[model samples]
Target: MTDPRWGEAFSTAFAQLTALWPDKVAIGAAVSGLCALMETDVALAYICFGALTADMTARVAVCCKRNRPLCRGLKRALPRYVCYLVFIVMAWAAQVAFQRGLHVGLPIVDIMLAYLILTDMASIIGHLHYLGVPVPPVLKWLVFGGREQLKRKAREAAGRERR
Candidate 1:
């Protein structure tokens, strides 16, 4: 018979790993860009990038619980992710509006995807900030203004909890 404690440990490890999967996929998207072969299909590459970035943004939202909108029980983080989804939809719609309505020369796919890359970077850095991880100078400015914003948010949350 399998040891119950061992089974519990395995279950816990699996849960943690599953929770981390989105972050790993985001890192994979970054590493994929380094591969010359993937560049051959530029359109597909951009689509993949767009999809990954949208997912990463939502996943990052799911990761940061303290600052998230209030929801209850098993699906508390879900509403927060929905907010990120709205941002993704709006971004795509803006790209369409800019290209079709205004008759700009911009490629909608490329522009929207490139914008999503920036958004993903911001979310990734934000996640790092929430985790108390050290981030580089560029990402610092891009995400939280050198952790001061994070510190302020933390202080605000503490004050609220004290009340």
Candidate 2:
């Protein structure tokens, strides 16, 4: 299983990143993955997922069309290309770190799980924000806590039943 703390950290990081740059960074990262995915079979499915994210960006672009302030602000901040470059480099670094047993401090899978959680949280929050929905901070935190609590409760209940 993945470390729960990673997801929490990821969510926090994602929230901050999205708050700063909105969807441009995310769309760029997704596009970068698509470029790489086209070159590898094992990664092709992930590339398709990236393409779906690009679609989301297109939607956001449409939604923000009339909001010139938000549009120009997001456009001027960062290039999607840089974000995509960072995404690939990070993935490569993580793989290298794993191969070198850098994950001795924690399982590599757990680290990956953390990034996944962070990414998912970022995506959902960005999407909600894009649609002008009010995403509650308490509710966002619960996304991390609820699953762990449910799992723990289930385990305890199972143990009791066995006894």
lDDT of each: 0.54, 0.53
Q: Write the per-residue lDDT of candidate 2 for residues 1-163, one digit (tens) a residue.
A: 8667988899999898779795877776775565454332334335434643554464456457656555553563335435544654565565556456533222222333334444445555666666677989887677556546645654674475445
- lDDT by residue for model 1 (1-163), tens: 8557988899999999999999999976764653332222355445545655554555545545656543332253345446544554564565567556765433433333444445555666666666677888876575445345544654674476446
Worst 10 residues of 2 by lDDT: 104-113
Compared to the true structure, candidate 2 yields what TM-score? 0.34
Listed per candidate, the RMSD to the true structure in angstroms reads 14.3, 18.1
Q: lDDT for model 2, on a 0 to 1 scale?
A: 0.53
Residue pair clashes in candidate 1: none
Output the lDDT of residue 77, model 1: 32
